[model samples]
Target: MNERRTAVPPLIVTQDNSFFFEGAAAGRLLIQRCADCGTLRHPPGPTCPQCRSFEWDTVESSRRGTLHSWTISHHPQDPAFEYPLAVGLLDLEEGTRLVADIAGVPHDELHIGMPLEVGFAEHAHGAVLPQLRAPGASRTEEGES
Candidate 1:
């Protein structure tokens, strides 16, 4: 029997941000750091905004962060996500903020400053990305939704 598969759009990986995806594929969360100014940035860029330096390096995150903000979405559903999806803005221990899907904790329990950690999950198209979870949550499980 022929099976139909839902395909998530492929990520547009560019030279500036390839490291981020590569890291996630390797079960790591890598952030770009400006070699000259020691500033950290997310959504990896070609040059550091703080110092406009082309020289940069990667830092492995502690994978721990506080929930700085969050929102739940319910409309315009996509095949890659579940309904009532919870997404969060996390303030990482290393001083950089990253946004990711929140899981393992109910929507009501999520609060500002609650501790969470980064975990990798395979999404549509088998792309690995970070998912935020409550501390001590299992990482071996596949992403929900």
Candidate 2:
């Protein structure tokens, strides 16, 4: 049987949120945090959602979290979604929740409150997308070099 190997996607350079693209490309998961209230925020906004303060900082999470919620998507929303994808929300250890694609596992095996880790999906367009995986899960043989 052949295994599926994942690749790194190209990056899209933009002015404000370019760091997100770069971080995904490098396999690092990054999110914005409010320096004032120490609240974690996703989508990289300029202001803190909790304190509504402009003081913010870039933070890298451990990429480990629990599955908050999820859904299996068989329909392709875009041409890039060629395979069956699991879209999920991860509740990070830092009290932040992030929306990402869950990979490296079958959709039936996914469960709420399951431990998850972060990974990067390399797209052909050079833009990397963040993905979630079961704890200690590895790619298939096709994914290996």
Candidate 3:
């Protein structure tokens, strides 16, 4: 995978959330899918909120999403993050919305309904992340209508 320059720290993954990180390492964006109701959920968990079932699994995302909302931080919260950091929400095609750092687009230009794609940024400690980017940044739409 190509190196995506980023300064944020690697995300911590535990027994409950290893699937997301593992998928990131393998260069795929993964989200939680309800084994019973077939609904997708982000920030993966043990129970399906839709079906109230304890059964769940991972689904590799379409890696395509639309920018829903955002707030750029002019104040530096962490030196690891660049000034004007864009922390935003994306509504994925699979019906799940996730919060992640939006990259490859000027912070000031971000707005609602902007097309986006995923890029994997490898952390210094070796964990990978699913960072957001513009749709035209060499990403192909696969199996997504």
Candidate 4:
């Protein structure tokens, strides 16, 4: 009999931006929201700059957004990444813009304002990185290849 081994999942840690990791593992996309004025924030800060409110809350994002900007890298910045990878800024429905890799779509098909959803990619080192893709797109067995 042959035995197959399953790799352990990545460990996500959060020293300051614990909300981001906490939400990811739970399959919920979360961003920082101001408790005082209800403004959404990215990069998860300790305070709301607009309202000067120290009180903040973590809210589940729509997991849906539009492509704000994008770039294709022919040269790999990190050796682990394959050539011709696309990275982009996704503007979430919650009003926060997130920067992550735009995957599972051809670069020629990318356009600003195209609706997208969140996806997760597990690295060789076992770290899970957030990725963006076209709406209704799936990483496996569906959508544009």
Candidate 5:
């Protein structure tokens, strides 16, 4: 048995963002919302910067967003990742921005306002990661790479 195993990136779960990971495993994109002021925050924190409120709750995101910004990495920071990786900040319709790896789109085709959707990338170590994918980016032209 010479099965090759790929390494999965580690996920740091804390009390603040545990719900985000749990939602990822369940194929949902969750965001932290301030219960008091109804303000939404990403990279979940204990206090809302807007309202400075400790009271918070979770909300399932629409999983749809526009590419706010992006950078294509020709260099792989880790051996587990591939080169020329595309990363983008998704501006969710919920009025929050999410930074995640963008997939299923060619490097040259990426635009600042391009639409993307959330998807879960299953890891070999049983971790599910949230990633972005092009909504309708299939090649229909003949001989298109």
Candidate 6:
């Protein structure tokens, strides 16, 4: 039998944000920091909002964070993701917030201020990306239990 697979979206990697994707592929979490004023930012950009400096560097995050907010997405289902998907906004210990998919935790168990850790896994399209999981939880590359 011939089996078909869903096409997963690809990440838009640019010079300004390549490090973040590279870090995820390497199982490391990196955050962008403004070299001039020591300000950190996410969704990597070309200039620091605080200092307006073009120079920047990366810091390795602890991957430890607290769930600041979250949501369950079930509408307009996409083949790339599972239904009732748990996504969250996390406040990393490094002081920057990141949005990532939550795995291995039941939605009812998720709460604001709950501790979480970032994990890397292969998403659709064979892209490695960050995922939020309970501290010490182990997940396969496919992000299954």
- Candidate closest to the true structure, highest lDDT: 6
Q: Write the per-residue lDDT of candidate 1 for residues 32-137, one digit (tens) a residue.
A: 9999998999879999988799999999998999999999999767767887999999999999999989987999999999999999888777788999999867
What is the per-residue lDDT of model 2 for residues 1-145, given as tens digits with 9 covering 90 to 100?
1223435244446555777778877777888778899887777777787788988777898889999999878754455555577889999987788888887777888999999988777665646777787776534422673
What's the true lDDT of residue 81 in model 6?
A: 75
The Cα error of candidate 6 at residue 141, in Å, is: 8.8
Question: Candidate 4's residue-wise lDDT over 74-101, tens digit each?
Answer: 8535545656889999988878899988
Worst 10 residues of 6 by lDDT: 1-10
The lDDT per prediction is 0.88, 0.75, 0.77, 0.76, 0.81, 0.89
Per-candidate clashes, comma-separated: 0, 12, 0, 0, 0, 0
Of the two candidates 2 and 6, the one with more favorable lDDT, higher being better, is 6
Q: Cα RMSD for candidate 1? A: 3.6
Report the Cα lDDT for residue 18, model 6.
Answer: 96
Residue pairs whose backbone atoms clash in candidate 3: none
Query: What count of clashes does model 6 give?
Result: 0
TM-score of each: 0.89, 0.77, 0.81, 0.79, 0.83, 0.89
Instruction: Encode model 6's per-residue lDDT on 47-108: one tens digit a residue.
Output: 99997999999999999999999999998676777889999999999999999899999999
- Please list all clashing residue pairs in model 1, or write none if there are none: none
CA shift of 111, model 5, Å: 0.6
Give the poorly placed runs of model 6, Cα more than 4 Å off: 1-8, 138-145
Model 3 C-alpha lDDT per residue in residues 1-145, reported as the tens digit of each score: 3355556556667766898888888888888888888878878887887888888888888889899998888874655456678887888888888777887789768989988877776554567777788886635433342
Off by over 4 Å in 5: 1-9, 123-126, 136-145
The parts of candidate 2 lying over 4 Å away from their true place are 1-15, 138-145
